[model samples]
Target chain A: MPMNPSLLDNPKSDRIRRVADLANAKARRRSGRVLVEGPQSVREAVAHVPDAVSDLYVLSESEGADTEERSPTLAAIVDRAEQCDSIYIHRASEAVMHRISPNAQGIAAVVDMGALTSEESQVAWSDTPTIAAFWQVRDPGNAGAVIRAADAAGCDAVIFVDDCVDRFNPKVVRSTAGSLFHIPVLTMGADEMLAWCSAHGIAVVAADIYGTPGNAPRTLPDMLADRVAVGQSKAVLFGNEARGLPRQLLERVDRIVTIPIYGKAESLNLATSAAVMLFSLAMSSHMGRM
Target chain B: MPMNPSLLDNPKSDRIRRVADLANAKARRRSGRVLVEGPQSVREAVAHVPDAVSDLYVLSESEGADTEERSPTLAAIVDRAEQCDSIYIHRASEAVMHRISPNAQGIAAVVDMGALTSEESQVAWSDTPTIAAFWQVRDPGNAGAVIRAADAAGCDAVIFVDDCVDRFNPKVVRSTAGSLFHIPVLTMGADEMLAWCSAHGIAVVAADIYGTPGNAPRTLPDMLADRVAVGQSKAVLFGNEARGLPRQLLERVDRIVTIPIYGKAESLNLATSAAVMLFSLAMSSHMGRM
Candidate 1:
């Protein structure tokens, strides 16, 4: 973790331009890397997925000269990256760091997308594995928030089913607040998600306010009280932010459940709904009938 | 219910300028009015708090010349506004609409701030009345989202204790998605909140991750299982988004409870946490012991 002494003062340099370009999807794909900004995100990437992080950038004490790390927060991340043994540390000027990421807060990391892009290999699950899946969740912020909520609920994995936003998007990464490093996030087609769940003996529950005709939705509270269903290995699937789940997708799920609007709110947004439904089931299963 | 034939094509007119100025707090205070943007908020304002609305501005079909309402959504809101005989309906050009509110999706309203500023009078409570209160919630978006979440949870009211974001802020009203009109939102100082709850015989439950010394935080699940607490009149108080509740504030509350994090994800944001905790408690209270 020896710091590179060269001060990256030129924001228009080729290296700086390439790093800034990672904000775009095309550049990320072409370079096979990601720019993880902010101290929390950078630290999480270096700690949880050390193999994925290739470079660490810290803002220097001076404006254009590379001196010491500007803040204790940035220094701590640099120290943590040293223990990882693979991360290359670099100190850049404030302007350079700002150009790298406006949300970076004096620290940023370049991580290999190879480790993040591929799907995790199937593994033997616990007796009652809980997985969170999303279908057509297009908003990066919503996608990240749901992933964080799923992680907090102790889900085994997060599956993005069909036409979802890319997981490596910077806004998604920032909004996840480091939870992206804690769980395996994979992408699959709607059919593939159903088939995968079936092969693994996991029930697929659609978190929809309204189910297709003849398949009315059950309130989340009712589903929680079903001890057998609560204790079973299952995947809770959420819908898009606005349109919600299509009838075709709803018909394939094992159960359609909704978080009841006890008051006058027409509906909860995607992120809030996911947090409530996932945590409710998780807590119910963990705490038993209580 | 008749539509005004005069078209408002001038964005720079004194009337248009005054309506647009409501975006600022000073202007709102001086004029005693607020700018409500988008169809959902305008519709809700007309439906639930008709007396507060003074003017309705709908985007016209043409660019520079005011014409008929351009979209069915805007037309629906305009129709609803017409039902409120006191609400003066005005058609504005696209440029005028944009000047009033950038997010005004073809409709905006000027509502009297008088109806929105005062605290609600004390009311008799149900056996299991639940109230959601926030302390020092500054973020407009989070404030609105929590209001909506509280509404969804069937809370009796939303109390903005201490220094919280203005309830009439255009961003807050927009983020609420009409829930601001669905529930009674009041403001009070910290002392007032405590005194109000005590007078009403409502227990104050502080939702804090880290409880004060000698007062450990109880997990939400365990708290929910306590039937006596769930069925009693209670006020759940959440802290600031980042700093959380102060030690002094926590000491004054009846109980401190927390939502348990089961996975590596560190914590939930203010809006998400409010939704999860409020919905969990509401569902549990409504369904009894389950």
Candidate 2:
């Protein structure tokens, strides 16, 4: 049976009207809280049993609209959480959601974002710790999708450095489709990111679409060709679509690389570029043959 | 100097309204018509031309009262396009553009999409031309983005087969960021696709997230390695994310493949998955060593 709906819709139910802001998302970082947005993601978060989802936001008015798509089933999923705590905001008007979110497909939630803090935070990283670093990438959707690709590539983490989009932004949240809850996202300025790379002994490669940024080898494949510093962490940095990386930032890294584009299409989308690089790393790791 | 403001204020401009549908997009497609949307894209589209834009939309009664972001510069852009025989849609009633497009981002235009579609077709009839085939992709955005990836990967053409999304869909057109105009997108049925593959002597490699439909090879790299028929054309078929390809369809293909995924995360986003395989093929082609 589903959780009691009327209980959540009562006038006393104050939990439903809370605004989610950057402060809320940042608070999650401190208290191990991670915000999960929308209905499908809320359920997935519950299933993953991430650090106890703190709340569920459902439309009190739409609660009466009966369908498996909305209420009771969602309520049941919330009930199945580590705690039976789920609440519906009686005032969740579509306009309210639209105003508050880039696009609130419907529901949103707060869960434990999970235990990844830095690149080295994982003691036992994947055999192929494929890392995608956004260096000055400004698009929120592209940032979110890169995190999703990192998850798909089975990468240990997706990190951001100097001038990249905010990983916690709501638009990025919507684009990730819950991958944000699944992957480790790290952020820092160039000095700090470079410091981590040096200490960890990871091979840092720069991915520039314009091709002038030179690294240890010729091109992307040459870097992928026997570039794995096995038993050491590996990170590849992708930068601004038009300008790529700042010269100082590119120089601090181990190697510079680029995907060979064959047409006059100008440049590939950032997310598409991330997918290609992450997948290439995955293949190299899987084959284990440099 | 910018064109006259009164000319842009006139909504009766006939050439201003031609970009509202596929018939018009196709008309533009035939007569070197190009469509540009949003303030940024429009600005770039106009700056690139003495060639001439087709039409322009400027919301003189701009919403969101931002004086800096959307302003007289937009009016100036419209004025310039108008001088080039481009028509103008003025003070677009909130209802008109909203109905025509919910995502206008305040301005739009019909510009020449780009050069070359008018010159000659890119259809390849040789024995070993490379190609991409989308079996049942349902997202127009993903479909269009895959076309963009194919353009980057140097595939001769992208074929759509069985239950594909509408390629001409606006979301797809926008997602490709005009790369759709660069690639030849052909739609065909299941039988026709298989026949085309066979006739071209293309080794049709099917891609599924879980496993290849029946048993051709375990992963894409393996499939590429095992094709036996070297120097033959290759058509990579990607199936629906949900159900994948039916057994009968898989059996008709020369090979089946999976992307090597590491995370517990079940699958890659459809377009991301497609990009991985496509770039990997291009790598093989460039290296002259699969």
Best by TM-score: 1
lDDT of 1 by residue, B1-290 (tens): 55576778899999999999888988989998988898888888888889889998887775433434357777777777777788898877878998898999888889888776645663334567899999999999999999999999999899999999988899999999888888888899999999999988889999999998879999999998999877888999999998999899899999999999988898999999999999999999888865
lDDT (CA) for every model shown? 0.87, 0.64
Provide the TM-score, chain A, model 1: 0.96
Clashing pairs in 2: A16-A89, A34-A113, A38-A107, A38-A108, A215-A256, B34-B111, B34-B112, B34-B113
Which stretches of candidate 1 lie above 4 Å from their native place?
A: A63-69, A122-124, B63-69, B122-124
Show how many residue pairs clash in every candidate, following the order shown. Answer: 0, 8
| Candidate 1: tens digits of C-alpha lDDT, residues A45-81 | 8888898899888888764433443567777787788
Interface RMSD of each: 0.8, 2.1
Steric clash pairs (candidate 1): none
Q: Candidate 2 — which residues are off by over 4 angstroms?
A: A1-7, A10-13, A19-34, A57-107, A112-123, A211-217, A227-232, B1-6, B12-14, B21-121, B125-127, B210-213, B227-231, B241-243, B246-248
What local lDDT does model 2 show for residue A111? 53
